[model samples]
Target: RREWSFTLPAIVHAGTLWLMTLLVASELDWQIALGIIGETGLGRGSWNEIAWGLVPAAMLAAVGAWRTWPVTSHAQAYRGLAGSGLAVYLVLWVVLVNLVSSGDPWPLPYLPLLNPLDVAIGLVLLVLARDLLAYRELRPAVPHLWPIAGAVLFLWLNAILARSLHHYAGLPLDLPAMVQSTLAQATFSIAWTVTGLVLMVAASRLRQRLLWMVAAGLLVVVVVKLFLIDLSGRDTLERIVSFVGVGLLLLLAGYLSPMPPAEDKPTGEDAA
Candidate 1:
């Protein structure tokens, strides 16, 4: 225990791992900025650069994943080592943004949010969240929050998709455009409602009061947004459909999912 408690070996290991990770990440950033693999197309030199950059990243991630496993009692020390490596791997997206561009019209159909880079980053977050955040003995509150994070990410994607569609359709930024966009944006509202309903059902199945409350919170947000924002276009067909659709979904949710029971607190003797 003494050896594991921020001792010299642990400190040295953490520092070394972080330093190596930073170095590799910096190299990858340079490669991306130089457009080793970009719109121009791939070449042997590009492949070499990509291979060099990704190989190090993969190695670091492997080391982090291996160290993160609770195979021993020194979970805290091990987590530090794991985080040093994994943190860089997770944040590589941020480091590689703003790559030099030709400044020509955007060739991609989707916005930056839906680009391959962003998609890859989202996937990485989902893949790493369970390992990095879910350990009941180490951190109880964390496991409950992944759902919220996922919900936020899902909502963001839906919104960006709606925006991209509006752009692709060449909708002008005006009142009529707003009316036209009501249907497109209503899709996001529907998605939000569905996400809440799913969460509610999951909460009921898992019998988790916290999760049920989270689901309720999401539903409340949808309701507020519907009344405050969506109501502006009350005369629009999209708004009518939204109201009817959401109401029906809520009714179905009420029938299918009930609130989870609160967890019983330990009595004084039991706690002792």
Candidate 2:
């Protein structure tokens, strides 16, 4: 029942998985062959430089998106697969960052981290959130609600990812290390928060459900994350950034989606 548009993403995704597994296997020379560390080019040029690998995946995603414009029974699936493929590529980039630590005692630390469970948990939550938001069948009374869920899931994912990376980096377990962790988490929170705010504004202006689901949902999650988790271990500077950055973003969201002054914006749930 699958067509080319439906199947291309699958092929690309499977190819990517096979390629990554093979690439890592050859790089590590695990089991079949021993001793081949540092061949994979880990800790290579600036992380941004390695992004060239993403271009192909990006093009595929664009194709999927374009394909969706034509009427078809499986149009949504095409977009979902395309979007999912794109997200898979992005998440892989994050996972790859920690695989090549300079200090891990293991001879060649390229295996994806799964022992802690947080890494796996974060990955699941983010993927699920994306799938949920992307599903065209989800017709929430308030379309904006979906993005909130997705964004929150991603915030937790980001927090956990950063925290885990810092922990394994083998920094001395002291105040300095704690500060570094907090700083790293805070930096990600701020960046995601700002991005969410921008999307929220865009969603408001366009009055589009898709935009609200991702953008507005982002703000919801970031605010929750700021209070629930990020507040505890962070230092004064980190707190300032969290509060100032998020506070300003909240103001921006408000500006863009300014509330009904007893009448301006729609009152019912459909307004979203």
Candidate 3:
């Protein structure tokens, strides 16, 4: 069942967190270790921090496991606990950011605590939120493709307009700066365009024909930017061709593929 699947991942995540804690302790002194942990803002620094952070995490894991128990169905409890864990994590992130940014020394040597792990945690929370949202039947009826499409258009247009205005004013844009700006713009444009194309393909009601339109428009704009760049003839064209080619491939894939169906409902049949 889907709920069981969710539960397993949650358990794995909690275990991973505990394992990470052990590793941290082994690598650092107690004062530094406690500082790093407290700086994470999952809980306040005191006897209560461990009680709050680890206890809730453990409880959520237990609830998830219970969802799989044959005698007792704890799906609702699992959902509530998981949602609470996510909220706690988000609040901690905000508090930690503000605390760190205010020029306070972390209890540790300011270890890079915020990394891919945070992203992984955020993603897991998003998954939990999606499930809870769906359970309440509050899922969006309309696909979210257009908003992404609009963002892509806005960024692309703004970049082009800025470049044009700079040129008209005869402002001396340095070569390195120009390349950096162009690359950044191209990166965001390609990313959003790909997302839009994917959403268009996946949503049944979305017009597949429009995928090509968006692709073509993006291609034209990128091509124009490349041409306007002051690079040597062959190198400029090659760079342009390479990026455009990849973008086109992604667009083609999105246009041709259909969206996957929503996940199946979890059956409460698995035993813990």
Candidate 4:
């Protein structure tokens, strides 16, 4: 026995199928368009590779995150659709960054942050962060690990960029030995301290207590490293600069974006 007609369910399923097909077709169209433009070779160069990869993913992500779909269902298909875009974008980002940073003909310059790939990645992250903040309800619907994963990616990129700079100076590839030097050690500490401060500012702007705690933990690690390792090294311009820079950043963090307020527990009187 049936309490309802099959008509609505049928229409919904049909609509989902239609949308899925449209998305797949659009992906194919992108590849075909790239072929027509004579940039069909994947892995020939960094810019061309990104054109064939990140550009389409970015477009899909922007569309999914921004557009409103009419169909709604218990499975929350719309949320999944949007999450798929984010997932694909992130996966492609990891692949491209590794490829470009390692041995691409167009390696990241001495200033890796200003390189095209990192700049694009940073802009995409900023836009995604803005969208996520604007649509609060979408937060729980998307993958929960993205925030932590993004932070890890940021840290890893900074290390890779630093390594690139070190290699450019014709230094040996021995990481442990490299860190023993004044400049390398200072670079590492400064990068971590700056990263922590940036995260603190972001946490304050986002009103996220968890993010604030994570930033605090990162700062603690930097402090521990400073005391244990940096203090043992001879005083040099690099070391002095690192210490001064960290001090200024700490002051800025305190002034501009203090720790987020702790959550208040409900008391008996409040409950009443």
Candidate 5:
């Protein structure tokens, strides 16, 4: 726990330092600063880039330093740091988005709703951390698999409902010319839907490494399509490709990875 005490303080300190840097940087070139703020509308850039990027990446080098000494379980420390970090980051994001939106020429579209995924993931982590800290006794009987199952079910239900609703409403949900090809549309819709399911499930499980890899690959594909492809304002195909590819990769990885040991039950704390 002592390690977490330190780690949380460090992240807070780093975030504060980064925020200060950005405030100073914003003064240098207001246009560029506004551009940075606007980029989030296209689903990129945030305080994470402005502040955290400036910190030495090695700040995490000593994350597990106390593992050997075992003053407190490494898991405990990690949970503490993660929870605190999430809170700090969320507040910073809201504040920065508000600040930038106030002075910009164009309105920041739904700044409050910016980065739904980040909000969702942070909430999940916060819940997990709380469970790890306060409910150690209840972990054994809790079904850790519920997260994966629930996510899958949620995605499946939502996709089905969306399709049904669109059909019943007789809405013209057709893709643009560039993405309207039979194969392209089908490939994208199916692939993305599957990928979303995979991501939801993975997020529920708290698989950090897998989540990061999936997110990175998807981001790369999405960026290429959005910026590089000249689809004439009709770039739905790119998003479909990103979602489908990332989801497929996540599913493959999940299948190949070893399952948790059957007899090694989760502690009560894990369930919370």
Candidate 6:
């Protein structure tokens, strides 16, 4: 068992991040920023300001995690700290901002914009999350959190890039918004399906059921998003094409991502 230590530096790290979040997040106007995304597009929106505050915050957390990963005596504590800090940082941008903006004043439900910098920051956090999971020193609390953080970041990156495509295509505004957005959904689904396959393979290698479960969960999210959000108001033929294409994609994923084999029990145990 590892000893838990209460050190000044550890307290400092936690305290500093918490204080920063509270202070900076207080002044940030979520409604206005999302309005920018809805109007000026993802590339020009107020995300630049949010990114200035949050991207660095996420970077700082990931750096702290990497630095403390190798310390023996403090490894466990640092692992917890790293995962906690990372989850908190990523959630601020990924979930919190989106949830807040989607309702209340702005009432825009589409995803918030992510600048190039935010995507880059998300990449860092995704790598850090994997590293945290790789370390057994991480507490049980970790497996539940860091993987979610990584998934959220992954989705955020895809949504951000997808928004650009939706914009560049310049589809007519007269069409139902959902129907117009199907192109983005189909494109994004391809990536999501591919990512899900990779996750299933990773889960197989690590023999972690949770990883496979999350991968399956992601595929489900894509299916639901396509049907409920993107396919609404579309013509019959377009809907048919999407359903057929996505069905084939699911079949491919199922073929490529075999579940781990069941282990044989000892004879006596099996008999018992």
> How are the candidates ranked when ordered by TM-score, highest leading?
1, 4, 6, 2, 3, 5
Tens-digit per-residue lDDT, 129-243, candidate 5: 3443444544553567445434543443333333332334332333343244333433444444455445645554664545545544554554354344423335566555645
Model 1 lDDT per residue over 106-182, tens place: 23444545554445445555555544444444356566656655655664455344444445655443344544467
Worst 10 residues of 5 by lDDT: 53-62
Candidate 4 backbone collisions, by pair: none
Tell me each candidate's TM-score.
0.62, 0.40, 0.33, 0.57, 0.24, 0.54
lDDT of 4 by residue, 1-272 (tens): 00112366544644564466457656655664465333455443345434434444454444444444442332233334444444445555655565344323343344555655555556555555554554556667456856666665775565465546555755544556556766766777788878888989998988888988888888888778777777777857877887887788778878888878887999999999
**Ranked candidates, highest lDDT first:** 4, 1, 6, 2, 3, 5
Model 2 off-target regions past 4 Å?
1-180, 257-272
Off by over 4 Å in 1: 1-12, 33-60, 65-85, 88-115, 133-181, 263-272
Candidate with best TM-score? 1
CA lDDT scores, all candidates in order: 0.58, 0.50, 0.43, 0.59, 0.41, 0.57
Inter-residue clash pairs, candidate 1: none
Reference-based lDDT, residue 109, model 6: 33
Error of 4 at 220 (Å): 0.9
**Model 5 CA deviation exceeding 4 Å by range:** 2-188, 196-272
Residue 239, candidate 6: alpha-carbon lDDT: 58
Better of 2 and 4 by TM-score: 4
Regarding lDDT, does 3 or 4 come out ahead?
Answer: 4
Clashes of 6: 0
lDDT, candidate 3, 1-272, per-residue tens: 12332466555554554455445434443553465545575343222322233333433344444545521443432344344454455445333332222211223221122322222333443443444354433345224535443553354334433333233433233435445454444444455455455545544345444554554566455546545652233445445744675568566855575444454667777432
lDDT of 6 at 108: 30
**lDDT: the better of candidates 2 and 5:** 2
| Model 6 clashing residue pairs (backbone) | none
Candidate 1 lDDT score relative to the true structure: 0.58
The alpha-carbon lDDT assigned to residue 121 of candidate 4 equals 58
Candidate 3 TM-score versus the reference: 0.33
Find the candidate with the highest lDDT and give its number. Answer: 4
